[model samples]
Target: MKVGAIVTRIIRQMVRDKRSLALLLFAPLLILTLTWLVLDQESSDLKIATIDVPDSIITTLNDQQINVIDIDKPKSALKNSEIDAIIETAGNSLRITIDDSEPTNSQAIMMKIQQALVSKANVQQVEINHLYGLELSTTFDYVGPVLIGYFAFFFVFLVGGISFLREKSQGTMERLFATPIKSWEIVAGYIIGFGLFAIIQSFIVVLFAVYALGVPLEGSFWNVVLITLLLALAALTLGTLLSTFAKNEFQMMQFIPVVVVPQAFFSGLFNLENAPLWVEWIGNFMPMYYGAEALKEIMIKGNSIDAVVLEIAALIGFSLVFFVLNLGTLAGYRK
Candidate 1:
């Protein structure tokens, strides 16, 4: 009878939390639906540019379901990522230059090209070159930058949101409201206080990823750190803003499925190139997408900060917007 009474009380408590109940029932289904949308879509066509290649080779490539486009500047197209590869005749041999920024796409292009050549009689010698990756680069090398950005974002978001929520739940926010502090000042103080630790965390994560894990640092180390710090700030501001809506830590955690999980899917970790237009559109709104893209540009492609200015700008923009929203949310507590 005692155990039954305790169980009944716990059940009543759970039923009273409508948000938690809804999250428990619907979060998994939402994630599964997103997974299906990403994984079930047809892959985008593989486009290869051919310059002065034989008609037989082009026809073979087409037969193998690769799109072959005739172009005069195969090098430019490959560099611009306009095409996956460039195939051209170099004397008696055919030279294939692949954009190795994305190893999966490069591997796919290589497989299709080899299959096409093998099916044709008297296959010419093929010379392969990578645009960015080394011959020894692994899948980790391709994904490490994205992982760095993701971890930085994830930890900062989780810590900042929970910390801010704790302050509210503990009545610290109520005490502050009794002071002369403006709502924006409170938001600014929280960002600066949390941001110091976020900066430290970003540096630690980048250093470990590059040195301990042997992730290649093709670009300047500071560039990687800069992107990670910006991403962290974005996460910090976003977390504090969202925390205003959450009544407690449990509700803060509920934001994970709704906020963080979708960013993981939309971030460069998964290839959304072949997904529906709407799916890619959803990625546009995600700050992590820009963060991951900038990290890749610096780490993988060895590009300068100038090359990723747009992505950096996007991250700053997200931070500013979230900071403003945090200020607005704090206004409710002022009353």
Candidate 2:
């Protein structure tokens, strides 16, 4: 009888929280659906334009299992980043200018072209020029640093935001204020605690991405570490600052889609060729835009530190702005 009564009470309590029930049952499904949509899919067909190719070569290309589009001008197609590679036949030799924005596509196109010419006894050497990615390695290599920074930023943001929110919700913040704590002191303490964690987290995440995931780290590892720490600090400060406006943990969670999602759209994940002029400007306002760009340069281009000074400066500026805003927001909690 006692066990039955306890079970009934537990069921009643769970039933009362409709939101909790819905989140428990539906959130995992939604996440898995999105993951499948993005990462677990097969490679899309690579579209390429052949310009002035010989009749024999064209016939061989047509025989291959690939999408071939006959384009009027090679310049237009390449400029638009449409075609993966342009095959132009001048006499017996083929001149290939590959849209090397993505390394995998570049490699695939090169391999296919070679296979198409395999039967020819006099295989002319094709000159290959990469449009975006130079003599670099993998396509995933470019996104490595950016992904590391993003994961660090995201995790710290959620953890810090919720921690600060809990302090307010549990009335611990009020108790602290009643004692000798100043608003800035409380903010500083939170920053230090979270900031230390951010440093360690950034190091581990970057190292894992570079060494374990085989994401290229052409630049100095310390520079990557410094940039990741700065980015995480920016996220931490932004999270704590935003938490001031949030009434509860649910409200804090709402900020993710609003503030974080748009950044990804501009962060080099998708080719932004079709984006509007205004949309391009929106990227200039985002911190991730600079971070992703610099990260790409460092990892893929093996660019020197001087090459990314502007981006590093912009990231520091973002951190400063968020820190100042955080300090201002904490004034609200002051007695």
lDDT (tens digit, per residue) of candidate 2 on 30-63: 4333433443322347676787776777677667
**List of clashing residue pairs for candidate 1:** none
Residue-by-residue lDDT tens digits, candidate 1, 90-177 = 9988889999997668877777788789777688544555687453234566667887887778777887787778779999889868
* Candidate 1: C-alpha RMSD after superposition: 13.1
Residue pairs in clash, model 2: none
Quick one: best TM-score, which candidate?
2
- Candidate 2 to native Cα RMSD, angstroms: 10.3
Q: Against the correct fold, how does model 2 do in TM-score?
A: 0.66
Best by lDDT: 1
Q: Write down the RMSD of all candidates, one decimal each.
A: 13.1, 10.3
